[model samples]
Target: MTEKRSPWRAIVLVSTISSYIVGGTVGGVFLGLWLGNQFGAKPFFLITFLLFGLATGFYGVYRAIEPFIGDEKKR
Candidate 1:
């Protein structure tokens, strides 16, 4: 038998995932801007850190969902 999951859990998970991605991306952009200004290399740092942030965000999403994936597999 499959157990029913709570709707609140889903809502919380979605919220967490969104926050992780948005926070990482936004934080990266801000940091990149600051660093670029400090080092006088705007374009390079901005692009690099933007990509880094995206990667970090995706990694975070994967990590966050890993437990749920494992639970599904066990069932």
Candidate 2:
């Protein structure tokens, strides 16, 4: 028999995933900004780091959700 997933589990999963993406992006941007300020190359560093953060965030989301995707496919 199929069992219902707990709401708490879903909430936690969503929260975790969102946190991962947001954290990566924010961290990257801030770090880039700081570095850029030091180097006096604001836009260059900011854009580079922003893109890197976006890639990292997406990758994290993909990895985190992969298992769930596999499970759904099996069913």
Candidate 3:
């Protein structure tokens, strides 16, 4: 069986993926900055959280896309 893909699907997927990565990174940076400032250890926490964010963001993308992948596999 063949599946028909919508043009908007690509747009939405790209947007959602970008949002996942960007949102996680930006949110983490801000939160880390705030916490670092509170703790008086700016760079350390900021760097750590930024890496954490990167990991979380990619993991989120994988999770978000996993169902689609499963569907394709079943087909």
- TM-scores of the candidates are 0.88, 0.85, 0.83
The models' CA-based lDDT, in order, is 0.88, 0.85, 0.84
Q: What is the lDDT of residue 4 in candidate 1?
A: 43
- lDDT string for model 2 (1-75, tens) is 244357876787798799888988998899899999999999999999988998898899888877677565575
lDDT of 1 by residue, 32-67 (tens): 999999999999999889889989998999999887
**Candidate with the greatest lDDT versus the true structure:** 1
User: Which residue window of length 10 is worst by lDDT in model 3?
Assistant: 1-10
Provide the RMSD of all predictions against the true structure, rounded to 1 decimal: 2.2, 2.0, 2.4
Better of 2 and 3 by TM-score: 2
Descending-lDDT candidate ranking = 1, 2, 3
lDDT of 2: 0.85
lDDT of 3 at 61: 91
Best by TM-score: 1
Counted clashes in each candidate structure: 0, 0, 0
TM-score winner between candidates 1 and 2: 1
Candidates ranked, most accurate by TM-score first: 1, 2, 3
What TM-score number comes out for model 2? 0.85
**What is the model-wide C-alpha lDDT for candidate 3?**
0.84
Q: Which runs of model 2 end up more than 4 angstroms from their true locations?
A: 1-4
Better of 1 and 3 by TM-score: 1
